[model samples]
Target: MTASVLSRAGADLSTARESLARAAQRVEDLLGALPVPGLRSLEQRDRAAAAHNEVRAHRVDFMATHATEVYDELTGGRTRDLRLDELVEAAAGAFPGLVPTAGQLAVERSRAQADKEGREIDQGIFLRGVLRCDLAGPHLLTAMLRPTTRALLLLPDFQRTGLIEMEAVRLERRDGVARLTMCRQDCLNAEDERQVDDMETAVDLALLDPAVRVGLIRGGEMTHPRYQGRRVFSAGINLKKLSAGEIPLVGFLLRRELGYLHKIRRGLCPREPEQWHAPYLDKPWVGAIDTFAIGGGTQLALLFDHVIAASDAYFSLPAAREGIIPGVANLRFTRIAGARLSRQVILQGRRILATDPEAHLLVDEVVEPAAMDDAVERALTRLDGAAVVANRRMVNFAEESLADFRAYVGEFTVQQALRIYGEDVIDKVDRFSGRSE
Candidate 1:
């Protein structure tokens, strides 16, 4: 390489090294500044502490490894073949198992990008671009494929009215039940950015509206012959968009964490002094599942307070196949379905049938498809709204607090960002779209 080119490469390496050093210092400062876990919400504090400790360890390894690489390259030694993990491994005896791999650094980078992009997109400019883009094939095949997108673009004035008219989801309130339906029947309720936004809006409305006693989540009736007149809950995140490179993976995952899922976990109310100490939404959520809930669909179902699946309905977490984590599935599923089951489902790509014993453990009730509506109604009616609200607070306080949710999300967000932006995602998306064998 030319001297000028080598000089530029050395400069880039120096910059990367400095960035790692700064990140390590910041993580150390964060650990020092964390509040002590107290009697109330102790589990949350413990989870937070644990998450931060992991971050600290990763940062230490990252900094140490990069510093060595910078020194090696500047000392007239060839550092061309140096791997981040190899450096960390060589120093493992100094800090056992504290070795940061290339993956961890990539994850950290993604986390930074997400933080930056999250703030920039708050004004909805990027979202408008995504919704307006004509690259997605499904949206072209049938204009109905993007009802929410079209409504948002055409009638920006009446967002509420447009949201109500969204063909991807139906937000309805009747007789104290806030019914949030995952529509998009033609695609089996696959979710794109607009659909997720609509769902988040509906969820926020349900949580904020005092009159909404119980929230019911279900899929709209489908007309396709395969699922004619039946509810096909959700196929998952729109792979078509992900494959077409329309939806950037990191932003998509970040939005899910900070948007609908966060809204579902923490209401529109104020949070505690600590950024992580968000208060839980008191309203109970009931999930009415029909044909299938796949990948991200199943992740959403895991968050519901009550789940009623049709006898023929099924659930699957196919993230392993897609080369991504199912957002917070590792944390939530392990708590709900045990670590072993979560591993089998996530790592093995095992499908859990509605009638399976494992499914019963996760789902509260399994009834005939025809009886799903009645089952959901009966389930909702059995619970006294005020009592449900009170009991939810007690249950959340005793078991999973907002702090716990945030800690899991904290780890998930960064880890997901890493996968989303990494080279692995490129190949995964290619395979998913059938561009690769």
Candidate 2:
């Protein structure tokens, strides 16, 4: 009886493998026929998008239904200690045209042109499919938390001096606090690839430091004529760079969420999967909002344990007008502000002022501009006294677990990609008049 059952199970495994192989072949054929070369014309783009969507639908369905089976096959039945990039490479080889290899994606990012839009869209769709696979989604997300190559190289210097200054960000560890200041003065402290890379490296420095008990993020003084010498929390995505096709979806959108912001919220994951459930190496983060937090800036405030804002400050997520999904705001805003208000804030581009009663949802303390420094110090002291790591871990476990984040990213990956390349977004970017908001 045991031999008969084993034989049946073996047959089923063989059948599933064969089905996957055939599906992969079908995807290869479809992609080969619909070669996404430049897509110069509207008609060409539309047709290519439709073809990509079909491929995406098929891939999503297969992964959703056979996530474990697919993962098992990719890893050769070894689930433990799997690296994310390795798994991605394996998938790219096994399922040609479904996903780009890491090297290919890197090359595309380096090019950063309108001509590469189709390939970028395909990469996003492929990531969405990967994120759907429960076995792989969380792994990929966790892998992003590891320090970047730049960060790793600078670690020794940071350890020696407790300060590292990059072009767009500066980090200093002092009195048990790792202070990260955004330094894109000319752009009103807006985020771009340079800023994001520097910011992530700074965050990595803070997390890796044993003496650091808390992390703080605040914008540096701006050089824009109107806001010259004054701090502006952040102007959000650098519209100029984004409109110029300098912002690749994977490098900026995906990396910002999966990398620094996530590191700030959940801390660093253990190298071993067995230890993931254990408490992460985390510290409470504080956001010091000076003038305003707009779009991606507002999204950043949501991840902090404590947010301190100047009485005259305000926050807004104008992603609706920008024609792209605000990074993870949809998943997070509703929880803080109720569904209705969150809708107003996100969908209607409503701005919440620091002095308003409703601002309490996003800001923990509102202080006069002159008193901001004192307020931040007091908040840090309070956080230091409390069991910050324990409390944060408990709160996150209840509010946004790894599984919850994984699912949200899985869906977000595809939606944001489509929005980024949509006609409406292109039109909006063309009409942008150099306004920070």
The candidate scoring highest on lDDT is: 2
Off by over 4 Å in 1: 1-163, 249-251, 270-281, 422-424
Candidate 1 accuracy as lDDT: 0.60
Q: Please, what are the lDDT tens digits per residue for candidate 1 over residues 21-110? A: 565456546534654222224565565556545645544444333443332432224322212123233333232223333344344334
| TM match of model 1 to true structure | 0.62
lDDT of 2: 0.78
Q: Pick the candidate with the highest TM-score.
A: 2
lDDT of 1 at 388: 74
Q: What is the lDDT of residue 102 in candidate 2?
A: 71
In order, how many clashes per candidate? 0, 0
> What TM-score does each of the candidates earn?
0.62, 0.85
RMSD of 2: 4.1
